[model samples]
Target: MSYTSFREPEASPPPSRPGLLRRLARDRRSMAASVAAVVIVVAAAVVYLADAATKPEVSNAANALVDTPPSAAQAEALGASPSASVSASVTPSAAATASAATAPKIPRTGWVPVDNTAWKAQVSAYNALKVDPVPAGVGNLPEFRADCQYSHSLPDDPIVAPGLPGASHMHSFVGNKAVDANTVAEDLTKFTATSCKPVQDHSAYWVPTLYDNATGKPVETTGFRVYYRSHMSNSTGQMPMPNGLRMITGDAKKKKPTPRGATGQFYCAFYGPGDLDGIARSTNGNWPICGGDATLHFMMQFPDCWDGKHLDSPNHKDHVAYGAGNTCPRSHPVKIPAITFDIRYGAKGTPAGYYLSSDKEGKSASSMHGDAFVMWDVDTMNKRTKNCVLQRRTCDNYGYQK
Candidate 1:
């Protein structure tokens, strides 16, 4: 399946031709150092990008596979990370040991691509743990839903589930539910031999809503922020992120405003359909809340697919690939980041200081956190009014229309 093109701001023209390195070197002290650093970084980036461009053949041939695990090298290319902990391989916890008693079952594939070298190793690790396969049975896990989390803001009002007009909606990016936080924590402790260190001040959250796709008019919404604390922290029991989870914001839909104006000015924000705008000025890399606020969520327990494709499951519209080339938000092209990981679960499994802040291994899988996943037809919580809305109407409907 394919996704619609996300409306993007007119990209500024490529940087003006810079003076040659030799010419720049002729300049005085600090400028020379900065230029040399920039050159080195740019060269490294080019090489990584070129290497990541080679798409692996996702296959079930089993025999023609390598034993390499996904690592930051590969993830950096894809613009995403694999899983936390690129070093420090930990032995399977009691949970994995108990579950491993059963034979590993290879997942069936076809719907999406699973060609990355790192992903294959991840699949192997998951199989070793005997985690349940993707339940939908169509293909590997939905690429968009498989990772730790893919952050983005909505461009239109979301559609709410039936019978829950005013119900709170939490994102299942990692498959943790409001009621499953405890279970998630238990499983984390049970899976790793490392002493379980509790993550602090974390909680689950869902700000569902439906507003005008064009006018930004709201139809319905839930208005409160749900905190999450069940996420796993490193063995030192220290929070990896000093500022917590950064606010992710990007308009993946890439929808053009009516009359053909640039909608790229929209920044990323935490709550409200119309909250926040633009990624650069408001993202973790910028001021006015540099790196912004840190928000955490429970990642799904089981491994899914890693092809980075859209999910076309029944009951769901398969928005990612549904309208390729269309103006719809989900039709945007799939941009897989370079994420890194390995089957080695011990202390030496991955690099230090890069993975999830919740784990001992610092190395994390980098995902396309630039865009926001849109949730429509749902009653989203509004902090300003401390109320909610549903389906183009106030969530408190009590009558039928003629």
Candidate 2:
């Protein structure tokens, strides 16, 4: 009866179930552990991002970016032409840049050589021309003359000391009026204003200024006759004087004493009852004093042969040479018109005499020198050389053989 009444001992009270507060405490501890794990993961991610931002990017050999020029399509997408993109990306090598910097620059203006194809063609054409035969009794002088007056005075010599103003002795210039220390071949060709009679002759001529010893004044030339002639008897294959041909006659540095009959001495020019060496002698025994209506005159002859290579040379005279007998020297094979300067002064000469600007110490006429810078119309020069020189006839200022 007692066993029946019992409720199976209440199933042992469900094994003493836990309280609500204890359960809550255990759940809070588990939640705190999970939150700490999440915080640690977030901190590790933040540190990785910060290190990536601060560190410099280094190139790995296998993954290095190539700086190649953009393709045409890529350049177009970037709003640039392909050529511009390529030029912008490329750079000159250091060696090329250094070579350009160290290379000698060719001068634009100066005594440049005449070695162009056009000039060579001109030489060939000149050589191929037919020489006209000389008629009988044509005076036998293959020559022409340029009558020039005094142009201006300057202490400048374009041939001797180019671009250096006042570097030369005082020179009385004739022919081309625009001649100066800075004068070039182009200048003479362009500036056609000349003191010479033939307007086509744009050449320049200069000589040292003659100074009177007593008055200490410069004596300018009254007349300057430039004779272009050939000294050879057989005047065949004479070429026209090249434009920009420059040469000097006589030695300005010759300080030797020039007596009355000395070579290259200045003498008198008279007609009747007078000597070519003048009547009296100067104090230096160089200059001559005329007795009659004679005045001081000097003749300077330049070489007739050219080297046909340079427009000018170092000494200015080595490029030219006087022809021997009837033929030019092998070194200077081109037969050009020889230039002769017949300069006349108004003074009759005195005992004190005169001194050339080039000869201050020597006070002699032996130092007298003349410089010629030739320029002319190509047609005129050719015509004169053909008609007057090759034909062996004397031509006047108009280049006509009468």
Candidate 3:
């Protein structure tokens, strides 16, 4: 976690003190030379100070959390004026701001801190009834799996601050042993282990849960399964997720919304995974819901397309992009593995019922948001992505040895 230190060479014996030179019986001209040496040193000091003043502070991009304001299109339907100015501020200091272009370091926290207060509100145009088709031959393909535990007591949610319950919204988490709104890459990677399938991937994954606002009790994803694989047709293999990759989808501000672009899928089960006929329901294509005899199902999909440069973005979702119809674009050519969530929560009510922190009313899925914190063992990701996904082999526990 600590950067290697470089020991400086001993300072040149202080320019050989003039007093010592006197003992050598130096001439008067030699004394003038000594004075000249002192003058040179003073001049050098002045120059160093002036240069330092002009140069920007070495912004330890590690701690920089920058954000810009939302765009006009984002505020169009959100009741805010499109012309509203966004505060492109980086917290921690303001005099010498952190460069928006600098990629932050994520070695310790497994998550890069970000500020999305001003990101362009992703419009409904982002998703036009687009549904990532199910991976048809899951059993025959190599897949990375994570068996995340279901927790009613909040697991550490890395995006939302800890203990300050009503600030943003409520969420449940799985994977990293150490996670919280302020969590960093180190927190997860340095932990003893994780609660997910790839124990080595110590990152946290979370989603907002529906609760009965009246009761103030939380629902559950009692059992969670995360499957990661190549989501592109032409890609032979996938790239490992960079540490500190933070992303969000779905609008947490829309009082009533539907699932469009974000990986917000809900349905009912009838003895199988993809059986959604009479039971599948959603509000205007926003939040989908399915209620059955046993439980309610939630499925989410992350973009397999990546820009290949950033681990985190100002808005969190900008760095990575979604593939078009399961084919990655040249712009986001690197095919990082895509993950799908198969979540089930116990239910006892009608199909149209669920709760979100954004709107206690739970009437609209518009306020829903899903946060993802990505971190993993470099070796593990490389092996699985190359061997299972690229090779088109179905595997459990990686399906092959390194």
Which is the leading candidate under lDDT? 2
Superposed model 2: Cα runs more than 4 Å off: 1-111, 121-138
lDDT of candidate 2 over 1-402, digit per residue (tens)? 001111222222233555755665576677766654554444444332322211112113212222331233222222211111111232334433343354322112222354444445555566566655555555657898899999999999888887568999999999999988878788888898999988989999999999999888999999999999999876755777878878888888888888889998888997776799888899889889998789999998999876565566657776677876676655455678999999999999999988889998788888999999989887777777878887778788875554
Which tens-of-lDDT digit does each residue in 65-179 have in candidate 1?
Answer: 2223234322332333322111333354343333334422221111212224543343333224321222222221111111122122232211222112223223222212221
**For model 1, what is the C-alpha lDDT against the true structure?**
0.22
2 versus 3: better TM-score goes to = 2
Candidate order, lDDT descending: 2, 3, 1
Ranking by TM-score: 2, 3, 1
Cα distance off (Å), candidate 3, residue 24: 57
TM-score winner between candidates 1 and 3:
3
lDDT of 3 by residue, 1-402 (tens): 111223334433345587765644455456656654554444434332322211111213322221321123223322222221223332322211222123222122112222222211221222122322234455556566767885333533445443233444567777775665446656666773677765776767787767744466677777778777666554442444555566676666666454434434345555755435324444344344443454556667777765444455445565566766555454344556787777777754344455675576645555656677777675565556655665655655544422
Report the poorest 10 consecutive residues by lDDT, candidate 2.
1-10
Count of clashing residue pairs in every prediction: 111, 0, 28
